[model samples]
Target: MSVETMTLQEMKFYTGTNPRPEDYEAYWELALVEVASSKTTMEIVPSNLQFSGVQCSELIFSGTDGARIHAKYLRPVTKGKVPVVFLFHGYSGNSGDWCEKLAWIQQGFAVVAMDCRGQAGMSEDKGGVKGTTYSGHIVRGLLDCPNKLLFRQIFLDTAMLVKTVAELTEIDSYRMSVCGGSQGGALALVCAALSPAIKRAVVQYPFLSDYKRIWDLDCRGSAYEELNYFFRSFDPRHEKEEEFFSRLGYIDIQFLMPRVQADILWGIGLRDEACPASSQFAAYNRLCAHKKMVIYPDFGHEVLPGFMDEGMLFLSGVKDS
Candidate 1:
């Protein structure tokens, strides 16, 4: 079922064209320390979206730079502590409807679905770095200081979510996992890497890895259209090509993969154009922890039916990766 531009053999070996910045580790370590030390005011306002056997609440807290981050927290009506799974949505999308998340209650799971900053969600994007934003977040903090990069802050937000959820008395932090597809997939990896609290990750057709490979493969039009827009609008001559990619390297998931302690349950559509299989492999090949890939040869970046159920099983200990 493999229909990739690059043969499955080649894709497995592909390590990516995005260079890892020398200070990448130090930068993230410092950033994590900074966020951990910051006092974030937390509040869980009970949501009116009620359902049987499920209690829904909006978990809002201050992220780095005081951005108001929000997540829909769903806890099943159970006796003792339940396993938790942090859910991240696709780019420009919100934390999905409450009804969809309630399905996790079948496994007695506690779920947290985050709305990324400044997109189509209730989260706030406080970076406000006046720069060349191609109406997309990848380029939002590009022209400003490297530390202001949007994904950097988004990654921080994920770790913060894990930190926030672990404090709840109704959760077993040890059985936690992170799950998503496309942009959500990339974020799942980022969260697992930053917070080893996550034991499993189900990533499908993840975006935001191997940026240079995507550029060279010409797979930059869909989710990555901003890269083209940035080059045409600012670096028309490709003059700062290396400079920009190097900066992006800071947030590239391949660089962060080695730090991921979670056992991976990665799903890839070999025919995916929005997030090419080769680019995804570049990060997949670098993972240090145990991983199992679920390749969908005939599928694209669109929905892979039943993947949701599969992810839930993996997260709930019903299925082993």
Candidate 2:
């Protein structure tokens, strides 16, 4: 019933985390270099949608293999440099899912929420960045080429969104932040780490941080089904883990943590049985940026109403005095 009831320790168990921070950091840095090297500019044109008091637009951006990616831009009615916040959805979700929770318009911030490629509730006609790799199925894709991993395209899409947001007329290029929950939270972490423009980030029960521990724990969400599928299909020896870790190094939050310069507000749900506390802790500890954490004893996976209010209050007044 209260925010205090939620705790991070319980959430860690529900999520999963065992690997050391050093391993995570080393792996992600390699991934960042690879991602940076492969990035290319693609055209993003405005769309036809329009909202009252806001300009609604869309973009056709470059993605894995030239697959067209779609994104929605929400701009303040007034012409000025407004702070920006980009919202990303969890697995099986899209930008439309977070319409009600957007605080950018009300808080005087421009918001752009993007749909991850190959997710549920997305336009089937529109191509996915790579392919669908849910939590339960993470391990299955390790064998694929690094470029083929779903997270790679998702991360690239996030970077593109940030780049695009900076170019928008209504947004201030210097003031940007990213926020999301679960898979979205993980993406927020990745984006915050890679993008220099983000001023702050608030992540809730983030996923894909510590890979080995989570796969072994076999947590609650269908996202982990990917891991189970991978193990059953291939008896990966030590060589496989070594190679997989090498590839995952680019995308994991640990390596990205040191790169993040923005202030952070991280939330951990005690009942989070999917993205565990240890992994979350791994990311938090590696953060070189100014950061703080909120533990919810009773909540799990989603950020509760109370935590949201607190996070907003913190975000509104987050500037250094």
Candidate 3:
């Protein structure tokens, strides 16, 4: 962890450069309405991937725009309305293998690992945006109306999944939670904000926070490299910089933090250049619910030691039993 990027004191008060749009609350409220209006139906099929004590299945559901979304659902065979956890993946990544998620199942948790739309997964993305879908999802609907932003639909998809999971007779809606790293972490926060049923969230080095801060820090590589690409390819002169960033405010997770009702357990790596410590803090500080942050001073974007164990403890409301 380099003190050169940001001091501990500075990170505590960093309000971030990405200004929240004035209509931020109304925008999300309307977006939620749109998601609610879309009739979502879910289908679950037994999967070949088997675990000793878990039942694995392919969970498919319709998202906003009627795009078919996919997730891997794993539950303990001996279950009676057990707690469930929604697992999101990293940027450009899929839901991951069932074997990797057996730990949670062993802890008596039902896990629904989702593959984000159009990512490296079975999910379908109905692309109808008017702009360049060349590099990343951030700029997918930049040139069109704010409603067309890919994340708007993605965020809605997360909310829709939560709603579907909450309504499941096999799940204890009051005990539902979400967990993920990087882009998945961002979606975890988004899901918690959009779904009041989510009881807890375990987010690690979440992406999609304070876009202008990422630009100012010149730390726009890896998952956020699309920001630089969008600038160079679309607005070379930086003339539409304000408009672009402001439009990006629609999907910025920092602005969505206030809407989160779930208890949050945030993990951050001080040495993370990908998501940046300041950007992570920007969203963490806005959280008004019961929250705790675990800081790994020497870590980067990779996994933090004992994070899964710690996360399970947090979500289970237990102390390493």
TM-score of 1: 0.95
Rate residue 288 of model 3 by lDDT: 87
lDDT of each: 0.86, 0.65, 0.88
- Position 155, candidate 2: lDDT: 77
lDDT of 1 by residue, 1-321 (tens): 332468889888888888788888899999889768867577999998889888999999878678888899999887899999889998888888998887777778898999898777788778553222234788868898889888889999998888878888899988888999888999999999999889999989999998888888786676799999999999999999999999999988888999999999888888888888998999999999999888888888988878767877887788988
lDDT of 3 by residue, 1-321 (tens): 442367989889877789778898899999999877877699999998787878899999989778888999999898489999999998888888889988888788999999888778888878732222334898789999989998999999999998887778999888999999999999999999999989899999999999998898888777788888899999999999999999999999999999899988888899988898999999988998989898898998898999878889988889521
Of candidate 1, the 10-residue stretch with the lowest lDDT total is 127-136
Q: Which regions of candidate 2 are displaced past 4 Å? A: 1-50, 121-137, 236-246, 318-321
Q: Count the backbone clashes (under 3 Å) in each candidate.
A: 0, 26, 0
Candidate 2 TM-score over all chains jointly = 0.79
Full ranking by TM-score: 3, 1, 2
**How much is 310 displaced in model 3, in angstroms?**
1.0
Task: Compare candidates 2 and 3 on TM-score and give the better one.
Answer: 3
Tell me how far candidate 3 lies from the true structure as C-alpha RMSD in angstroms.
Answer: 2.6
* TM-scores vs. true structure, each candidate: 0.95, 0.79, 0.95
